[model samples]
Target: MAMERANLLNMAKLSIKGLIESALSFGRTLDSDYPPLQQFFVVMEHCLKHGLKVKKSFLGFNKSLWGPLELVEKLCPEAAEISASVRDLPGLKTPLGRARAWLRLALMQKRLADYLRLLITRKDLLSDFYENSALMLEEEGAVIVGLLVGLNVIDANLCVKGEDLDSQLTQGDVSVERDTYKQSRQGLDEMYNEVRRQLKEECQLRQDVENELVVQVSMKQEMELAMKLLEKDIHEKQDTLIGLRQQLDEVKAINVEMYQKMQVQTHTHRHIIQQLEMDLKIEREWRQTLQNDLHRERDSVAQLSTEALQINGLKKEFHRLQDENVQLKTICEDQEKALEELGSKLSESKLKIEDIKEANKALQGGQVWLKDKEATHCKLCEKEFSISRRKHHCRNCGEIFCNSCSDNELPLPASPKPVRVCDTCHALLLQRCSSNPT
Candidate 1:
């Protein structure tokens, strides 16, 4: 049952699509003789017959498509026209013949899909003629009805009255027709879309041009009005200029008389000005001489003031120098006293050195004792002696040195306790004791 519905659905789709394309190509009009139109009717008849229930009547097992198609009139009032017309036909005796005639009339009215769609909605009424699985009673029936919507655009002008409606022509090569139909439909759609786009662009361009032209026209009108106003003002100014030129002529005549009078006065004034210029020249010479004397006096006064300032500055400098000399004399006197005290200490140090040398000769042979003033630097390190660097007497050698050079202590035969000695003297005494075994 499902397979039957599938086949019928596929057939309905191809036939309805190709028929709509060919109808559009033929300017939406088809006659009974057109091959695609005849094939569309045959496919629709097969779809209606598939899964149809058998009705036992006086004629035995009647399964005519006309029964369900007639139910369209009861479902919708608008189908009454096709119903009455089909019934009134002269020679449509068989239900199949009447059904075929009715389809043509309904298609001409452009309501074949509408009438069938209404009949399919009422399954209870359709059950009398079709089985539960009939294409008319299932979803396939509703789909085929929907595909008929495209056929509404076509005006099918069929005169089936004189023709035989009971017999139908077999379908032709629908697959090839379907492919050709697709290519043509695609090209037509593309051409229509391009034309619609170009038309829209042209409309926009025309609207822009019209708006610009309107603005230009309005500007031209404004310039014309302004030009007229400027010309009117120029005429008024030209009329006033004529009167101004007449008045100028009168003023020129009065100026000529005044120029003659000024000429006479100019000569008399020229002689008086010459005499006054001579007097001014003498006055200017005398004034220049007086200015020279004033300048010389001012220079003399400035020279005297400068000399006085110089003398005052020199006097201040001399007083400052005298005060500095007095202070320097006092410092010199203090330095002289310090030098005398150093001389006395030097003499006392010489006497002590003479006594120490005598004692060194009385004892074992030894080097001469160094006086305090004679040893200005340490003998070992050669550092200059200052007040902080005091002299030290070496017990073994009796030589004067800084405390740092004579810091070592060692026991000596002359002293019980350890005595300070120079680093050289300490080493010499230790070597002597180690060798002599006394």
Candidate 2:
């Protein structure tokens, strides 16, 4: 029971170590900078520490030493008897007590295998610590395997010796340690070498994996930088395009403004041309009227000079008659009276001629006024004729009007003098007269 308990404790210890080593190995396989891998390592470390404590507590338990005794008895009661007999044998107590230790060793082996499997299943156990531990585990496994093999050989020999003892009641005739020990030693050396070689190969593989990961990380960084540069370039190009578009818009606006100014100038030029043509026509008409007035004035001046000459001749004849009267004044009294009456009559005739000349001058002034009125009427007619329709021309006042305002019969107010009624005024007067009975 003690042997079995020791074996169980050793198995638990190995199992815990193997689990920790496997977890560490998984951690190394992940990206070294991965935060989750770090967290996993922390959990593994905690679990390992807990396992160690459990192992220690288990080893300290009194029941743990004898826990497997019942199981052994159930499997083989003869084994218990053999154990007792070995304990009583001279110089064989220690060997027999230790013989059952194989059970613990086997358990340790299974635990180690389980621990390795745990490491293999995990995704983050590729650290240097894990690799080194794995190598150590491999070496340890080889040693454990050798021990197990020797134990198996020893158990077989014990089985044969027990059979002999049962048959012949003899206990000193069976011997198998020499050949078993030789075979175990040879197997241990070969396994050790193989374990060392495997360790070296695993180290090389781990290094290669780490290098590949680093190269991949660097390539990813370079790709990110390139993308950033491309994005920046695209943004710059967009800005340039926007600037150019704005410039194009400005140019278009300038062109539109220029086109509008040109149109306005064209309109102004046309208006000025029409205005100038109208002014030229008005100036020509004014010049022709002025020429006609000058000719009339010249004719009137010549007529006045001729009339003055004829009046001078008449005055000379009157003076000569008066001198003849004075010569005959002493000749006869009746003749003197006649001469005086003649002289008085001559003075009266001269005064009448002067009145006639004044009357003619007033008549000429009235004729000029009438001519001016006629000219104004003609100008009004021309103005009406220039329009599309013939407008009304007031015969009494010479005022122009449209066709609708040409009613001439209606009289204006008496206080205002002559009534020059348009169509509206004529209608208003008729309306008022109809309303008033008188």
Candidate 3:
């Protein structure tokens, strides 16, 4: 589980990093090709490459080139105004727009190429100038190829003619053959077709990358959700444990009280048994005294009848004392039986307490807090939290929500008083109370 979580986190980090790098790289490319509406051209290229819908403002050459053409717009405001009509031209969003942008880019490249060729033709009049112009032309051609390559419009290797031209120009070629120009043009057309092919391939690749990222993100979310559920389960179990601990303490107190009562009952029973023994001892002494008195009376001549009657009464009294002793024995037996039942009940209570302890032990281990407990958005309304819109947690469900969604304070079975809850829980609680009426 730990390894899986780590892998998921790593994948997310890499994905985010890749997106940041791509954006930064694109920004750098635009910055390097600044001045003379380079950024505008680049933006168009980017939109075309990604097949992205261009902003309506982008259709206007002046508006789209606002940064680079700022001076022109300010000095030649009328010209700028007239050029704003160019914005009504097609954009990359439609086929016509895309064709327009492509045509314009192609025309600009062709014009630059022609001017470079003219400079090459006038090499005799400008020897050193010729070399510099040729260099400039080579650089420009390379830049054009780079633009197409960056936009996935052409292959990196398709700039062979640009390299060959740079090599020939470096060797100080005074003249160029018509066949060489044709070859260069052929190379440019091949590069164009390659650009189209690469663009098509890039489109498919972009879709695949988007789908893969989406799937990965979705899987990450599912894993996170599973983790949250596990954590919630753990917290609930911990709460149950806490409750059981409280109950166990209460049971222990009750058991102590019951044990004290049992002790007192046993002590009382012992005192009663001692009193019965003392009574039996005194009765034995009285019977002995009665027997002596009967003997003395029998020794006297005329009191024989009285002594005999007294002897009979003594016997009857002795028999009655024996019956009382038997009744006391029966009462002691009943008391012992009661004590046995009380002991059994105490044992049962102990057993119950042990069972409760075992249950508490069973609930000993689980995580109470989620790893991503502070959600980015409200669970109920699905609104993202901002500086003014703070996240709030529902006390009952432990889910995050906006204040408006979880504003109600309601009583729950788990709480001692009314506490904050979400709308659904509040309604459910109300319905339950109404149904049960207790």
Candidate 4:
């Protein structure tokens, strides 16, 4: 899956490169048409004043069209965004002004292409819709160029009619001149109306562009603020990760020690069990000997008194063995209870460790720590906190201080806003700033 995504991104980058080149070529073609535009203006002026022979190809018509035929506005939502930026530029009423605007737009276009390339070349960054939107801008450029050419052609045709009217007047032809003059007058009126309509459209377009630019500028500022916030969050998380890793190592060491202790406990329990087994075996042997002695006495009744005394001694020994057995069982039960208590302590220790971990996590996640009110002196300056000089807390180090010792407000990574820091923290921050000046 990863390999396929990489391949697709590479292909998209190549396409973006091709599109950039095409846009550059389009701009160059427009630049080359400047001379032709000047020549067309001159020819039109001559045709308007005096009749002259003219060729259709004299205007050097641009025929290098290579963009989409569809309306870009309909295809690409981003086209409006690009057009909005054009309003930020100064007006282009003169030749020099237009050229400057064109150059600046060209630079902007190149920059935009670089930005787009970076975005699309990243995996899953460019969606299908955005891709289509990019291609739409290319068609929009083509349409603008085509419109310029069409406007020049219309101007030339209008001039041609003027020249014909002039010719009829020079030949002293009354009726023909009157009709041609009226027709020219009517054409001029229509041309004037068209120009006025185009002017109104241009003004409206400019207004829309201005509104869009304001919106874009505001959005850009908001994005920059958001980016700063994210960067600070990342730094804080990295610090938390380091702290957690240290705690993990300590927990691992504790676990190892606990394992060793449990092993020792198991050995002790095994030893206790072995001692009980030996005591039980010895008691069984002694009981068997007593039974044999009793059988021997039954076989010879003449030795009854002697056997009776021996039997009493055996009974007393039996009673002593029973007491010893009971004591041994009691000792085992006591040891088992001690072992259960030890296990409970281990479990309690584990729970305490987990609670400490949770507390540490909370502190890292911006839970504020305050100094105890019992403290009477500043931690850094050792100054007494009095009614005149109140106690203050450093947001960074969570230390109590006199108000003068903790007066600096600085941007803290854990907080969204700047916070009061102690003299020690402020000095450290300054040193860090000097070490890594941006």
Candidate 5:
């Protein structure tokens, strides 16, 4: 309807004009929390959403300005970054949130006007999302875009990731802004209503004054009463004014409290981000160290293979040890990936932390498995464990031995399958088994 266009155009003018004027007065970089800037975005959202076609899918009907905004990226290469940033922004779950954020980001980049201009020019593309009479499809859209050009002078720094964009719009429309601001400003709206009521009373008083002129003779007596009533009404109005002032003070106090809370929240978010970054860095360094350990282990394996003669019997154990080292390398690769994932998954970071601690403990040394460095030769045979004659562990005694000495397999209580045991332990177990006659 003509009325819709007219109203939207007027509001667009008001929002743009108001924002520019206020932002210039702001003197500093306008942040995401600026009031007039927020209102401007709300107005732009309304303009974009006007007469948007509802597309139905599995999730029910869907309407979002983001789809149209996405077209801007295709149309103009400069907008691609903004669109990508919006897509990657955290805490924004809905398409609408993305759309809202896209608008803010575009404004921050000072290309919002240019992007909108491109969009409006491509009516052929916008037609799918918006009706012909929609604000975006009409001259009103162009006018709004032109007005946005003035906003280029203003700078905005928005932390899109920190904000709860998906959390807005549940309470009401743009008439009220952010929820916290809305809660404080609710009293202001009540004050506005009181002012309107006061204006209506004044208008009624003027009408009565006009009627009194016609009945001057009878009005003489009624005028005294009317004057007395007017004086009483003035006192009541003054009392209302004082109450309004008190309410205004309360709202101002609430706003200050909310602002302080927001500052605290922002500081906390920065602290958390810094902590995560440090954690990520530490994880990366740990991963690098693990990679180094893997390389050294591989070098030791290579040296062992070069030294050992591949006898048919020794080849099997050699292959098994080779396969075990391969698994170790694979496990290290998987762990590297898990460490890389810690940056994005802060909640599950503690899982990787414990693993890191265990690795650190092992590096310092553990009591269970005899470290390879502790013994250069087989314990029982006194044969020097060379690179090819690789040292192996007897599962029962946790002592180092050459493959030939530890190759005998016997079932251990801890293991369901037969596992490697030293010759001495193997003999002791067999003798004990024969004596028990089980």
Candidate 6:
């Protein structure tokens, strides 16, 4: 049973591989302008070859062939549909279908291997079904028998009528036993021949399937090789695409760097140009200032020239003034000598005037002193010649005298013979006269 299961698994795997190979081959042919019918033949060839490979690989599990119909029913239900559809054919419905179905049932029951062997070797009776549609009919009939067995509609004792006959003959009398034996032998032979015919058809159908499977396996291998080649090409193209993309990226980066460098240079150039422009503007202003200073210096020079000319004119006037001053100095010297003489004369005149003034002042002082003395004298004279003393005479002279002078004894002169005399003198004369009086 383990060997049978392993064989089923391997067959399934091969069937799947064949189906895949067929589909791939069909697709390849369709992708081009290849003939459709040719493509179909190629696909069928691939399927047949793959199926044969599966059958050979599973050959050790030949006992599983007894239930090939069961396997077909379970694993390839689509094959069952094809079988059912073909069962309606006139030839397939006749004794051939019934006989094939019975034999498959007996094989699934595993009652007799020799019966199965006899069925597979009978080529003459199987040739009719093989010529009509052996492949389709055999596969379908086997599947039906397997189904019926699984359903318990059939049992391991495939000779159901023979069992009944043996039971009936046992219940009859012993005198007809030899006839029963002969009839039993004939029935077994007939059953064996029919089983042989059906099994031969099944074997032929299996052979045709194996041949088709071989063609399919060959086509499958070729398709697998083509797929490997296509995969390798795709990988190589992908690597080349990646390399080109990397190079493109590097170029873009280089372009970006160059653009940045250019921008920096442009900025630097613009800055330099701006600085030069500023320098030019400053130089222009400086030139204007120098021009203004030059104009001012020219004006100053012109003014200085005018001043020099005026100074020259002033020098000539100064020389003339110096000569005039020298001549005036000479005239001033003569005038100064004359003025000195006049000053000496003026000094003499001043001295004379001073002397006159002094004389006048002295005369005035003398006149004052004289007036003062005359006043004193007049006072004294007035005091002395008082009216009371008048007519006094001197006694000696026998002249009249003041009493005060006469007392002194000095003679007062007689009134001079009209001249007044001191009383004393008068007294003396009187005396002398008296003495000489003869």
List the RMSD of every prediction in angstroms: 36.1, 28.1, 45.0, 45.6, 45.8, 47.5
> Which residues of candidate 1, in runs, are more than 4 Å off?
167-438
Clashes of each: 0, 12, 4, 0, 3, 42
Instruction: Assess every candidate by TM-score.
Output: 0.39, 0.20, 0.17, 0.17, 0.40, 0.15
Residue by residue across 187-222, what tens digits does model 4's lDDT show?
556667998999999899999999999998999899
Question: How do these models rank on TM-score, best leading?
Answer: 5, 1, 2, 4, 3, 6
Which ten residues in a row are the worst by lDDT in model 3?
153-162
Predicted structure 4: clash tally? 0
lDDT of 5 by residue, 41-70 (tens): 776777888989998879999888778999
Model 6 agreement with the true structure over 111-195: per-residue lDDT tens digits: 3233322332443444432333332123432332232222222122222222222232232323233333344345556656987
Q: Ten-residue segment with the worst summed lDDT in candidate 5?
A: 179-188
After superposing candidate 2 on the true structure, give the runs of residues whose Cα lies further than 4 Å from its correct spot: 1-67, 71-175, 223-438
Query: Which has the higher TM-score value, candidate number 4 or candidate number 6?
Result: 4
Backbone clashes counted, model 5: 3
Give the distance in Å from residue 55's predicted Cα in candidate 5 to where it truly belongs.
0.8
- All models: lDDT? 0.79, 0.45, 0.50, 0.50, 0.80, 0.45
Q: Sort all candidates by lDDT, best to worst.
A: 5, 1, 4, 3, 2, 6
In model 4, the clashing pairs are: none
Tell me how candidate 4 scores on lDDT: 0.50
- Pairing residues by index, what is the TM-score of model 3? 0.17
Predicted model with the maximum TM-score:
5
Candidate 2, RMSD to the unseen true structure: 28.1
Q: Report lDDT (Cα) of residue 204, candidate 6.
A: 100
Candidate 2: count of backbone clashes, pairs at least 3 residues apart or interchain:
12
Name the runs in model 3 displaced over 4 angstroms.
1-374
